[model samples]
Target: MIAIDNVLISDEVVEEQFVCDLTKCKGGCCEDGDAGAPLLKQELDHLNNYYEVIKPYMTPQGIRENEKQGRYVYDRHFGWVTPTIEGQICTYAFRDAQNVIKCGIEQAYLDGKLPWKKPISCHMFPIKMSQSEVDPSMEYLNYEPREDLCSAACKLGKKLKVPAYVFLKDAIIRHYGEEFYATLDATAQHLKEQKG
Candidate 1:
């Protein structure tokens, strides 16, 4: 079991012992068109390198599509494009001779050529990071309750037997600071006691 943000998780969750066939159900979060997640400077730099390396492999139409949508633009004032549409799948996300999705970045990391890097947003899926204004509280945005594509994600989470708090805690720590974690814990406890 791993302890993150002071939340305990069973080893089963880490091993993905829970069956979550994201590929089978929703083709993973990237399928939807959400300019991909916001990236930290370091992650963006890494992605830019990967993008350059793989640019030649991408289909012409794919390049045109990405440019047409201006997919890289992010507005700090407006938040991300809502009802995110799935942009072009990555050029590296293709089947190898074994017919498996091959990621160049992951391979590069293994080869010691590049550090393991991925957009935080991409890393965390089905679980979302949201900030509340009234309370300045960090909350989990459970895609399960939403209609459209996220419903599929929700169903997948259920099949995986993913506990809501486990996923939620991870997201909080990833997006917010560790200090916010205890706040979330306290809030949950207070709500539970109120219910009881």
Candidate 2:
């Protein structure tokens, strides 16, 4: 049996007890828009450098999109990311020789080259950062954990055992900042209360 903990969800937010069915979901977040996620200056530089190194391997359309954007910007809900190819599901995702869906930069990062990291928006999904109009504070809201609706390709064979909130808080702080995280936490708590 596959060990549930081996599934790679967000390190800071996903807990061991959580299980998702990614097959049915179609990576909704990735297909939702063209703007992608926002990026910090340092992150943008890292991504550009990664792009340069991987230029030879990227599709022509990918190169064109990168050249057009020039820099990454936070597109509200999502952060900075490469623009998607026409009719393609994800800009950074592609199938390898064995036909496995893979992320080019993620593979590079795993290989020890520091590719630009994924934006928080793409990194954290289902769980969202929502802000109250009456208050500047934001909240972290998790869409109910539904394994049945996840994409088959992305699903693990076993259950996960980690707490979602812990992973989320760590990620928020890492990508945004402590202040932003605090606000998000407050927002999440408020939303939870409202739901209850």
Candidate 3:
């Protein structure tokens, strides 16, 4: 594990290879999960505050589900999460012309209807985060590539020589910061050199 400020990152984040192959997975991470996408406190607020603006991008069924169960539901395990449609796709997800599932909230952001994009939890996929048991203020970022949905991505990453941390650069930088990402990249390079 690597300790950087308040975050503890798993070594696998720099060792394991991963790059999402959306054409193959078709956003299975959003649809096949037992629970909906997890949300941060601010993300929950975004859903509540901008639902009217984002509603047009969502499916009718998704809107209905959100209406039935509040904008964001409290999960016993995940705290706050976006509601799923009948335990299937997320209430904020929509199918594109290619039949690929996409995030409606992100669509709204792309259209300039909303300022924030989708939840950070969703943006940072394969790298799951949780508060450290020993220290609540600390967070852990672990690389957890799903075989069912990410096999192609894993293979592609290996082919491209991209580690999980490198593949998730934008998300990591967004969630953490540019300095955090720079430190991680440097640490990863140093570790590689030591092993060699």
User: For every model shown, what is its TM-score relative to the native structure?
Assistant: 0.51, 0.53, 0.97
Q: What is the lDDT of residue 38 in candidate 2?
A: 39
Q: Select the stronger candidate by lDDT from 1 and 3.
A: 3
Candidate 1: Cα lDDT at 127: 42
Candidate 3 lowest-lDDT run of ten: 141-150
For candidate 1, the 10 contiguous residues with the lowest summed lDDT are 11-20
How many clashes would you count in candidate 1? 4
Which scores greater on TM-score, model 1 or model 3? 3
Candidate 3 local lDDT, 25-91, one digit each (tens): 9988888877998889888788889999999999999999988998999889988899999898999
What TM-score does model 3 achieve against the real structure? 0.97
Residue pairs clashing in model 1 are 32-85, 32-86, 33-85, 33-86
Q: Mind giving the per-residue lDDT tens digits that candidate 1 earns over 1-196?
A: 3344434333333323122354544444444443445555566456556665544544465455546654354546425431122444543343445443444445555566655434555445544444445554333343322246456545666777664545556555766567766665565556557669
1-196 per-residue lDDT for model 2 (tens digits) = 1111112223223322333344444445454444554354566677666775555545566667657755343455554555665634355655566544455566666666664445555555545444445554533334334344443312442334334554455565666678766654565456557669
Among the numbered candidates, top TM-score falls to: 3
List residue ranges in candidate 2 displaced over 4 A: 1-17, 20-29, 32-35, 38-42, 54-57, 69-81, 130-141, 144-196
Indicate which candidate wins on lDDT.
3
